[model samples]
Structure formats: structure tokens, C-alpha cells
Target: MPRFAANLSMMYTEHDFLDRFAAAAADGFQAVEYLFPYAYDATELRRRLDDHGLKQVLFNAPPGDWESGERGIAALPGREAEFRSGIDRALEYARALGCPRVHVMAGLVQPDAKPAEHRDTYLANLARAAEQAAAAGVDILVEPINGRDMPGYFLNRQADAHAVVQDVGASNLKVQLDLYHCQIVEGDLTATLRRDLPTGRVGHLQIAGVPDRHEPDRGELDVSHLFGVVDELGYDGWMGCEYRPRAGTSEGLGWLNDYQGENA
Candidate 1:
């Protein structure tokens, strides 16, 4: 059975940020993930996880000036210094939380900038990150975000992300395959998983309803069938529920219950 982790950043919006930990545990999630953790003290975050008996699976390294619309700085030229600082901060939290993965978002490609430069910067930065993370027993992940949701975002396809992993040639570097983005950018997810999962380069998985990011069961995708495929493929990492609920967060968890109930 695929272990599911509630994305506290996207789901569990009904509660305050700190309060979401208990809510997720109360709702039967054994693990949790979120976007950023730099705002809180690592000690307090660890306390919450221990109190609720939840494991922290993943979190994003800081995306530069998120409120000002800088999605990430990993791919931006001349920002390598900032990116490294962010990774250092992220690993500090990861070590405190006992997390194994840290997601590095590729920043948007400037409209008139040279693509080759951004690509070079991204690969170099990731190589450095992987080396730094390896010492801490953590893996670095790169995800492809669809253009519609994030226009100008670099790295928008699975093949592209995989190529990056190859280019970097770091064992600790891998891809974060999000099914929602995959469905929107390239349909035929079963084929995608079949090809990618066996490579040992995909470190994490995420899902949401297609066309409108909601519960996995509510979208055009037969999430149940896809999940079964994941199991058969032998992916043992966490499946992040990265979606917006149609109604309340907990109210839209029937899909989770259906799968977990059967497995339990």
C-alpha cells in the first residue's frame, strides 16, 4: 500500500499553520509535508511532530521572496549564493525534523534571458546541493511545474527533469513526480509511472484532481487505479495529497479512507 502524506501547505487550510499538524494526525495521516518551514523554529516544529506522532516527509527549500513572486532561485543566474544559503537553512530544519527529502524549485526563466545560462546555473547548484545534502542523509528533489499554473517556470516536463538528474549525476538527486502537473502537461500517467518509477530516480510522488486540483477521486483520473499501479511498481515513498479540497479538507478525504480502509 502507498503511504499517504497530507500536504499541510495545500490541504488542512482550515486550521492555523501550527495547528494543522494535529489536525492531520487526527484525520489519520501518519506523515505530513509542507511548502516552507523557515518561519518557525525547528525545535517547535519537531515538538509538534513528536506530540502528534507524525513524520516529516518533505518541504521546500526557500523560494526567494515568495510574496514578491519569486517562485525559486535555483535556476536563476548569479543567485547560486542565495540558493545555497536556502539549502543550508532547509537541511537544518530537515535534520531537526528527521526529513529525508528537500524540494528545490526551479525559478522562472526570464523572458529574454539565455536558456543555456539558466540551465547551467540550475545543474551546478543542484550538484552542489546534492553533495551538501548527502552528508546529512537527505536527498534533493526537482519537480516539473506546468506552465499554466506557473508561467515561465523552468523545468516543466518529466523528461526534462530526468535529464537534469542525469546531467547532475548525483545519486542523492531525484525527481518529485506530481501526478496533477503530469496529467495537465502530459497525459498517459500509467506510461509515465511505468517508465519513470523503475529508474530509481523518482524519489517522491504527489496527486490531485485534474482540470481542477481537488480530491484525487473527483478528477478525470482514476486515482485508485493509478495508486494500485504505484504499489505494483514497488514505490515505497510517501504519496503527497497535494490538492485543494472541494468542500472542507477533511470532508473531501473519502478517497483516502477508501484506499486506507482496504489496505488496513
Candidate 2:
């Protein structure tokens, strides 16, 4: 069976962030991921995970001022220093939590920004981040978010992410393929997985229902079938359940039970 990690940032929102760790454990999850972990002390978050017996599977590096809509600073010219500092901070937390991967957000592109300039900046920043991550034994992940959810996001296509990984020429740098975004940007999940998974460029995976970004059961995509594909492809990494529950987090978990039965 493919290991599924609850996205604590998007799941179990009824409880406080720190409290969600126990909630995920109670929901039968052995691992968890979130958007950012800098809000709380790494030691406190580590204690919560240990208490709940949950592994920290993944989280994104600091994305600058989220409140002001600065998704990331990596691709922004002249912000290389800030971007490297963010990588250091992320690795500090990753080391404390024993996490193995960190997603490097590419940030938004200004209307006047040249595509070539942005790509160069992004690749350079990633190259630097990859070196730092390698030293800490953590992998650097770059995800392609859908444009609808995040307009002007620099990285919006899977191929682009893969190209960035290739251009950086770092073994520790890999693409974080989110199925929800992939379905939105490009259909044919099965074929995409077949082509991309074997290349060894995909480092992490995420799933959500299409159109609504809800639990996998309610989406257009057949998540159970996709899970089977993932298993067939021998992907040993965690598949993150990065979706919003249409109801409560636990109430919408029937899909997981169903998947378990089918796989069994």
C-alpha cells in the first residue's frame, strides 16, 4: 500500500496547528506534512510528532511574507541572499524534525518580468539551495502549482519543474509533483506518472480532488487507481493527502478506508 501523509496545514483545521498532530495520529495516519513549520518552535513540533508517533514527511521553505502575497523569493532577482537564508532556516527545522525533504517555492512573477530572467534566477537559487540541502542530507523539492489557485506562480507546469531540476544539475534536487495541479495544467495522470516516475526526477507527490480540491473520492481523478499505479511503479516515498475535506477531516476519510479495503 502507498503510504499517505496527512497535510496538517490543510487538514484537521478544527484544532490548533500543534494539536493537529495528535488528531492525524488518531485518524490512522503515520506521517504528516504541512505548508510551513516556522510558526512554532521546531523542538515543540518535534515533541508533538514524537508524542503522536507521526513522521514529518515534508514541508515548504519559508515563502517570504505570505500575508502580503509573496509566495517565494527564490525567483526574484536581488533576493538571493534572503532565499539562501530561508533555506538555512528550513534545514534547521528539518534537522530537528528529522524531515527528509523541503519544497522550494518559486514565487510569483511580475507582469513585466522576462521569463528567461526568472528561470535563470530560479535555477541559480535552486543550485545553491540544493548544495545546502545535500550537506544536511535533505532533498530540495520544487512543486508546480496550478495557475488558477496561484496566478503568476513562476513554476506552473510539471515539465518546467523537471527542466529546472535538470538545469540545476544536482542529485539532491527533485520535482514535487502535485497531482491536483498536474490534472489542472495537464491531464493524463497515468501516462504522466509512467513517463516521469521512471526518470527518478520526482521526489514527492501530492493528491486532491479535481475542480474542488477536496478529498480524492470527490474528485474527477480515480485516486485508488492512481495509488495502484504508484505501487506498481515502486514509488517508496509518501503520497501526501493535500486536500480540503468537504466536511470534517475525519468525516471525509471514508475514501481512505475504501482504498485500504481495495488494496487489501
Candidate 3:
């Protein structure tokens, strides 16, 4: 069976952030993930996870100037210092949360930005972040956000993300393969899974409905079948339910029961 982690950032928005932990756990989710944890103290967040019996599976390292429209700094030249500092902060939280992985966002590319410079900076920063993450026993992940949701984002393709991981060549560096973005960018998810999961470089996985980003049960993608594919591939990582709830977070979870493992 495919173990799932509820994404608190998108789901459980009806409740306060801290309270969302319990909301997810009550709905039968064993683990949780989110976009960032910088706004809250790690201790407080860890307390919620412990209280709710939820494992913190994944979260992103700080993205640069989020309110100002800057998505990430990992690929931005001259922001290396800030990026490295964010890695430290994320790893600190990862340790506190007992999380095994962290996603490092590659920044957007501007018309004036040099791709070569950005690529060099990204690889160097990831290599450095991977080194830092290694000592903490936490893996660093890079995700490919599709152009529709994040225009001009540096990493937009699974192939590109995998290539970046290969270039970094860090045992701890891996791809956060989000199937929603994959379907938007390059469908045939089953084939992609067959090709990529065998690589053993995919650190984490995520999913949502195609075109709408809603509950997986109603999506164009057959998420239930994909769940079986993930099982067939022997993927041991948690598949994150990173989608906006069509209705109440709990009300829409009727789909979850179909995929729940016997022990879940």
C-alpha cells in the first residue's frame, strides 16, 4: 500500500496551522508535509506533530522574499549566502521535526538573468546544502515546479531535476517528484514512474488532481491506479497529498479509505 502524508499547507486550511496537525491525524493520515516552517518555532511545530502522532515527512527550505514574488534563491547568483543560511535553518528544523528530507526550491529566471550563472550557482549551492544536510542525516530534495503554477521557475522538468541531482553527485541529493506538475508538464505518469523510480534517486513523491489541483479521486489522473504503480515499483517513501481540498478537508477524504493499508 502507498503510505500518504497530508500536506498541511494546502489542505486543512479551515483550521489554524498548528491545529491542522490534529485535523490531518484524525482523518487517518500517518504523516504530514508543508511548504515552510520558518514562521513557527521548531519546538512548537514538533510538539504538534508529537501530540497528533504525525511524522514530519517533508517541507521546503526558505524561498527568497516570498511576499515580494521571489520564489527561491538557490539558483540566484550573489544570494548564495542567504541560500546557505536558509539551508542551515531548514536542516535545524528538519532535525527537530525528525524529518528525513527537505526540498530546496530553485529560484525563478528573469529575462536579464544568465542561465549559465544561475545553473552554476544552483549546482554549487545544492552541493553545499547536500554536504550540510549529510551530517544531519537528512536528504536534500529539488522539485520541478511546472510553468503554469510557477512561471519562469528554474526547474520545470523531471529530467532537468534528475540531471541537477546527478550533477551535484551528492548521495543525499534527490528529486521531489510531484505528479501533478509532471502531468501538467509531461503526462504519461505511469511511464515516467517506470523510468524514474528505478533510478533510486527520487527522494520523495507528491500528487494532486490534474488541471484542477483538487481531490485526487476526481482528477483526470487515475490516482488509485498510480498508487498501485508506486507499490509495484516498491517505493518506500510517503506519497504526499499536496492538493487543495474541493470541500472540507475531512469530508473529501472518502477517497482515502480505498487506498488505506490494513495497518494504516
Question: Which candidate would rank higher by TM-score, 2 or 3?
Answer: 2
Model 3, runs deviating above 4 Å: 261-264
Ranking by lDDT: 1, 2, 3
**Where is model 2 poorest over a 10-residue stretch in terms of lDDT?**
216-225
Total colliding residue pairs, candidate 3: 0
lDDT of 1 at 1: 88
What would the TM-scores of all predictions be? 0.98, 0.98, 0.97
Q: By lDDT, is 1 or 3 better?
A: 1
Query: Candidate 2 lDDT, tens digit per residue, 1-264?
Result: 789999998999999998899999998999999999998999999999999999998999999999999999889998998998999999999999999999999999978889999899999999999999999999999999988999999998888889989989999999999999999999899999999999999999999999899998785999878998999999999999999988899999999988987777
Clashing pairs in 2: none
lDDT by residue (1-264, candidate 3, tens digit) is 778999999999999999999999998888999999999999999999999898999999999999999999999999999998999999999999999999999989987788888999999999999999999999999999999999999999999999999998999999999999999998989999999999999999999988999998776999878988999999999899999999899998878875674326
Ten-residue segment with the worst summed lDDT in candidate 3? 255-264
Every candidate's CA RMSD: 0.8, 0.8, 1.4
Name the candidate that leads on lDDT.
1
